[model samples]
Target: MLAKSIDRLPPPRAGGWRYEPKFDGYRALATIQTDSSVQVHSRRGTPLDDAFPELVGALYAYLPAGTVVDGEIVCWAGGRLDFNRLQRRYAQRRHARELAVTQPVHLVVFDVLETAQDGDLRRRPLRERRAVLERLFRRIPARSPLTLAMQTSDPAVAEEWFDTMAVAGVEGLVIKPANSPYVCGARVWLKYKSRQTTDAVVGGVTGSLHRPAALLLGRYGSDTGRLHYAGRTTHLSDAQAAAVAPLLVAAIGGHPWPVRLTVN
Candidate 1:
């Protein structure tokens, strides 16, 4: 099931809700056949076995046959999860083995879709499925490149994790009803992310005065005190463009961004 994005976390209600960390990585489903062969599928159903050969091999070795799990493939860099590094690893066709050694990946399993004992667990309640997933993790060897993601029912605990774990690469929190089943293609889960606003200098624009495209943003560095490219905003409406035009004075000497470009 996919999660629907929300601006803020909702207050807990009478019924129970399970909160789990939302990872900033590729969403993948790992399937272990009856013969112990492993296959990894992306969220778009693209086969990812070749992209992450080591993870596929490890799943085959560690997980029981006929197991199907949902998780994220994450790579760590500079003491935090690096989505850019993961993207680069995903794009590699050759020299994957060498890159695997230098940039090892880990699969953080969150839910189990199938098991050897029970063919399909999607109909089971989330709490029940989580219990089974926890039991399965206990059987994995200590050195396996797999991790059972943490979950909690307490909103306070979820809030704490959202705040504290951000530095450790946790993106946000995903909340779901405890008794709800895993409805495929359903948006039953709620996502909460922390947002903060800061001041940035407007650098440039795309369209003319009548129809401004976007506002090029920049920030002054603390050490150098020079404007640096931050990012760009979405297209502005006609009224917004008119309001912002008077404030954007042409550069007297030189602009921060010399050439037209997008930062990200």
Candidate 2:
């Protein structure tokens, strides 16, 4: 089935709901059919089979057959989420293998879409789906590789987490509708970053850094019809070098987004 995403968590109605703390990482869907084989997908609808190899091992070990889940793939660094480390794994094979041995990997599963052939619950309310998810996760031993995402019904608690996580160098908060179903490709998942940032068009890039290369990300200006290099990230670990770098390069057309920004 085609999976969609929601922009924000919906408000509670007459019925109650379950709210989960959104993890700061890649939004992925994990599928485990009857044979216990697994597949992980990215939000943009790309297969993440090559990106996270270790997770494949974990999924094979923990997930059961005929079950599919929606969740985040996160790497904890210094007690909080680290995008740099997360990006590093995608950089090179050597780094990925090295980090796998050092840091390891974990999954924070939040939703269950299909439990069995009959349990295609994408259309169910978020609250009800979460009920099934919670019970199922509870049955799985905590010492196992998978972990349930932290959640709270209280807005205050959610806010508190947002505050603490921000101070801890985390990315942002993801608020989901407690009663909402898995709306693939939609905006049901609301992502609140520390700063309101957009994926701008990158006109040019800088030279290589510790690993392979650095990048210049930018956007098109409405009135000027020009591309401007807005930001640079030297901390783009190894993973970004291999995956995101090529994509950013390919996105360049004759003039880039605005057709004005140049390499200086």
lDDT of 2: 0.68
Error of 2 at 126 (Å): 0.7
lDDT measured at residue 141 in model 2 versus the true structure, 0 to 100 = 77
TM-score of model 1 relative to the true fold? 0.86
In candidate 2, stretches whose alpha carbon ends up further than 4 angstroms from where it belongs are 1-18, 94-98, 195-264
Candidate number of the best TM-score: 1
lDDT of 2 by residue, 53-119 (tens): 7777777776667888887888787787787677676565456656676866667887788887447
C-alpha displacement of 223 in model 2, angstroms?
39
> Top lDDT: which candidate number?
1
Question: How many clashes (backbone N, Cα, C below 3 Å) per candidate?
Answer: 0, 22
Q: After superposition, how far is residue 89 of candidate 1 from its true place, in Å?
A: 0.8
How accurate locally is residue 119 in candidate 2, as Cα lDDT from 0 to 100? Answer: 76
